[model samples]
Target chain A: MKKQWYDYLWILSLTYLILGFFNIMFAWLGLICFFVPLLISLIKGTKGYCNRYCGRGQLFGLLGGTFGLSRKKDIPKWMKSKWFRYGFLIFFFAMFFLMLWNTYLVFAGARDLKEVVTLLWTFKVPWHWAYHGTLIHPGAAQFAFGFYSVMLTSTVLGLITMVLFKPRSWCVYCPMGTMTQIICKIKDKK
Target chain B: MSSIRKKRKAFVEQADCVACGCCVKVCPLGAIRIISGIMAQVDMEKCVGCGKCAKECPASVIAVKEVTA
Candidate 1:
């Protein structure tokens, strides 16, 4: 049973589309669906979920591998700099903290749609435009932001990684990857 | 010929594993288990080389290769 690269791509896209649709509709369940595979993948290997079932991973892996950009054969010292790794980790964690803060606000009965939209606007980045006038309600923006922040932060980190180092550098400092590595280490110890 | 085939089903390589557990879950003969704190390993005698485990492993790590009887 030889596997083609596209088989992984198909699985990933299917999972993403199904999970994304469910997430956008039910909110909490969507969050669960999104993080669970990530948790599983991290514990297993990126190859398990990222390569096998993540649409974003599949897309990036395909694009990078196709162009001979996927393999990280000769990474530079600067790209592997501890400062850069720590910086990205700190930034990723900060985004997670902000998501938590927003979640706290939502739970505290502050449900003003305008206020939520305004807060997002304060970020003043172009990507916020995608969330500007969507069907997403104000009460739900925090949850949305939690997901969006991780995605956005990773995207930014990914761009930096692609530019400064090898294309898949985000995998090195990715919080999700970090979490998985931690799990794998623990699994190894026991 | 059939006796020669029986000798070939023992070893597994850990490096190529993606750890999806498909092999662990689908082993009809109950020959494979994902070792605790390690990757999957196969119990040779129990393996029938039905190819179920190899078929399901997402990483394509498991192979039914010939070995010494």
Candidate 2:
């Protein structure tokens, strides 16, 4: 079936990004927005939410493919390997756990959210230095971490894949996409 | 003379699919999906009869019939 206008889901990220920069609690709404649809896709045994309705996926298509030109080439062979996808999954979980730990520290009063937000570590690059942003909206640090992790990663992935391959190529190896594919398969047994 | 007719749309042999997901990348219409992570099944509704997936399939499992119904 042809994709409809509403199928574009990535456009919604603008809201999430703005929310995260302002109020933290509201930004978490983005998580709930996505996880819920993904949960449903598992039960439905179809990537309806992803293929037909994901905002971020739609954004990639709109910005990278529809309005712009994509290379329409194939991704690197290593990118399609199970090792690369699983390795990314592991790295994502590690960062997720660390985000959780940071949140725990704030809630436990051991290091407060304020300190965590203000905390800075600079890494000098050959040309310059890079530092984590100083200001995070007022909300759960976990939510901030989750939001940034997703937005930055998606943006980077969308940009790279759009250039190297097609706009939707990132979907092939997306950690969550892979996880849902696994889940839907497990849910259907002979 | 009947052989002159165009080939029908492609279909999966099921037993031959390796579920490598290579075809999924090449398909512009997103007509193919790995069902249960085991078999790559084609969505007839979404497939516009384009054979990009079949062309990209490494296993040679997807084939179109020379004769049409």
Candidate 3:
């Protein structure tokens, strides 16, 4: 059980969250997390990103396995079913687009810049402390707020599932994992 | 080029398996399953021995081994 370089990647997940808290601009870095999985799955035709490079998944594994925070129960069968996985993927994208729409509103000057991060799309946590009024378009900052919310919300969900079930149980229904898996399947067919 | 070629299949060292289900998600053929939250069981019939699981496994308890048909 020797640790590889990738094994320590969980630190990146934590660091991203922390950096985003102090400065919302750091949220743009999440685009790397967003796109790299799809790019790897497309080019390599494997779940290589989710399997080895996902910092969030590794964070859950570290918390649930190394720290023994997990109850070690099996995720329910329904969670692994194709129907639930696909449904979740769809829902996740809808929320993502909605976040973008909000950002667009700010960009278009139709809405005021929301100086808060919405957690799980419900509770809005005032985040003005993170933004000191950048000279850049407020829309960019708005996107960072929204994107950080998405990242944080997913991480919280992963942690919850990790404590309630298997350490990496969130991987069963992760939207990125589902998208990459679909990409892998399509590429393997060619 | 022997007539009988060696085939590799995933074998889980059950005693050491953390049953994290990383292998189950990465198996392209859906060949691995966690048995009641305990350990990963590989379905040799479905597994292609891609070693994706072996490499993805954090515990490193899964080994791809050559098996005779």
Candidate 4:
């Protein structure tokens, strides 16, 4: 198969993810980077992001593909079941909204930044150990949290899918992918 | 190309299936699998109705059908 153009997007994301952990200002990019694809998916559908330029998916492949650490095996039947897919989608949406709400509260001064930073839902995975590799100053904590949250969410889902199935497998059941499909269905109808 | 497009997912005719793994290998989502090392099976949830398997199948047994509610 021919190499796709977007296959290289991982380089940019990988750079930001690794270097941003140190310069928290660069980490702030994660806060807004999601919208670029969300807008495109509204027009071109999930394929715009999932099939083409998903950085997280590329990272998963880099870490777990043939040359990487993971061994390939057939995914279990239960994991492929409809119940698990939809349930994960629902849970994902709920957490997404909750994160936004918490962020809003911090910005509006209704809640402390510390509270938002340490929210129970902001779960981090082992990949974050790389960021701790940097000597993060206290002043950059806000940006660090944004960087951490974005990586945490994507890495959590990516790792789960990679461990259970193939790295790209999660794209099939992603909430954003599902939402993009719904948008395309509506557009096709009109 | 069929100009009359239908939102179709892959459907396998059991009798015509030779258990050849072409479709399984070609499927982007890994949605098609050989069950018990015998027949080909499609996972509807994983399938985006992409028709990649149909185009790749050697047996000419798999076709995409309109799955309207």
Per-model DockQ: 0.05, 0.22, 0.08, 0.06
Candidate 3 interface RMSD after superposing interface residues: 9.6
Q: Write the per-residue lDDT of candidate 1 for residues A1-190, one digit (tens) a residue.
A: 4555645653544454344333432234435435766577456533344333445544444444446444433345444344654575576677667666776676577643322222221353323433444464554655664554455445555655444444444544555544443456475665
Give one digit per residue, the lDDT tens place, for model 3 in B1-60. 778888999999876554446887668898998653445799989998999888656555
Instruction: List, residue by residue over A149-182, the lDDT tens digit for candidate 2.
Output: 5555556666777766766566656666666655
Best candidate, TM-score: 3
Put down candidate 4 lDDT per residue, B1-69, tens digits, no spaces. 756655668898754443434466568898988553235799987887788777645335578888753
Candidate 3 has an lDDT of 0.81
Q: Model 3, A1-190: lDDT tens per residue? A: 4468987888988999999879999999999988998787777766667656788888887788779998877667677677887899999999999999999999999999998888887999999889977788999999999999999989888888888887887877788877877776566667
Best by lDDT: 3
Residue-pair clashes per candidate, as listed?
1, 5, 0, 0
What stretches of model 1 exceed 4 Å from their correct place?
A4-34, A37-47, A67-73, A78-87, A114-123, A126-137, B1-69
List of clashing residue pairs for candidate 1? A23-A30
Higher DockQ: candidate 3 or 4?
A: 3
* CA shift of A40, model 3, Å: 0.5
